[model samples]
Target: MQTLRSRQASIAPLGIVLATGALLTGCGLAEDIADSLDTSNSKLHHVDTGAEGKESGLLADWVPDDAEDVHVLQRTTGSERLLTFEYSGGMPSECLEIDTVGSPTQEELAAAYETDARTRDFEVTQWSTEPTMQAEWWSAGHESRTTHLCGRWWVSETEGVFHAFAAELNG
Candidate 1:
């Protein structure tokens, strides 16, 4: 099974450029990312990170404690370390192409970072209901960060492969 982290390590740079380009054109970075996250025959796997399960890497520390229906989609590029967690009681009828299992709710997302606000490098810099509910963070090194989407999370890291995961998985 291919790992999402490894894939992200390869495409981090391109994602940054595209994200910046999209931002400049008022198209939005997340939309571009969503377009790139192809759902064709994509497979999602559930992980048990609880005790006795050796959870490693970004997902090990970033997934929220209350997150449910946690699933991961492995991609071929470094910017697509798709880790989706559903907190709502039931699944939504419709979801973005990037969503793995279902979708995410704003209220559930709000509770995700209510307790902890620190990731490996960046910190939660924005989280509000203005202009559509969204969340963003910034990194001290390489400017790596993440942006919360409708029912999932997207990471964009701009650093060496060894440190590329600093902002790759933020549940």
Candidate 2:
């Protein structure tokens, strides 16, 4: 009877060890599968508002001076970055101006603008749709090779005055 009891204890430990080994192996396999299917290449999005939005510098030289409410979005995938800025109470003419000086062809600018808007899941009024004008400028403030900016404005009796902008920063 004592021998039987000893044998039972030894077998119980062996079973526990086998189960643990199997669990660890299954976890490793699952992790490998997950890594193979992973598509987000270090993508990240950041939002800033109010005073923080002004200080974020995501808009580079295009940050509006008289904006009543400011919202900024910065999205990054690997080394590439896209910045979108939205503000209220800014004049349409003033908001559309790009002060920085690098003339990337209109096509290039439009491509960057389209890419920025396409990657975003959220809507920014009409700005997410086809922009009335496309623009690109070089931001000396940044270390990127080039930064492109696109903007749209809305002035309606119901919606009030608003400005939306999108920029692409290439590393």
Candidate 3:
């Protein structure tokens, strides 16, 4: 009769063969697993500069046909997506502004705006989001004044310098 050790040794080779066969015939299982587990970092500014304002879905068309200096940022994960747009010279006010933050939270976006304001030596007034759904703030220093706006579905930040351009256009 075969001893227990002998029987176990005999099955070990069979296990290796079966595992190897599965891997060989599994249509790149390793690659598929790696891709599914991927959680790589994404930078908003790394997207194509030209393609920024030209994305084809959701908030893409809301920008004016004549808007200038248009910039866009988008992030997608499975069924969730976030989109942001910035442009200048729109109706009523030709303000240099960001259009929206389509994410669920506004912390990162607010921080970015504050950083920009600080860099420009503009004092950012407290942001307010009450009575109306919009959250808005401004920066004013020297010859520069700017406004930033955001809401649950939309947010816009604009440089007041363009108000003159808007008045010129409307006048």
| Per-model TM against the reference | 0.25, 0.28, 0.25
Report the error of model 1 at residue 80, Å.
Answer: 0.9
Q: Which candidate achieves the best lDDT against the true structure?
A: 2
Q: What is the lDDT of residue 66 in candidate 3?
A: 44
> After superposing candidate 3, which stretches have Cα over 4 Å from the reference?
1-38, 41-52, 55-59, 78-86, 91-152, 160-171
Error of 1 at 48 (Å): 4.4
Candidate numbers sorted by lDDT from highest down: 2, 1, 3
Q: Which pairs of residues have clashing backbones in candidate 2?
A: none
For candidate 2, lDDT tens digit of each residue in 76-161? 33223333344564433422233333334444444434434343332333233222222232122322222224332111111432
Choose 1 or 2, whichever is better by lDDT.
2
Worst 10-residue stretch by lDDT in candidate 3? 162-171
Clashing pairs in 3: 97-157, 148-157, 149-156, 150-155
Total clashing pairs for each candidate:
6, 0, 4
lDDT of 3 by residue, 81-147 (tens): 2333334543223222443422212454354334332222322233222211111121122112223
Put down candidate 1 lDDT per residue, 42-72, tens digits, no spaces. Answer: 3344555322112544354434445444555
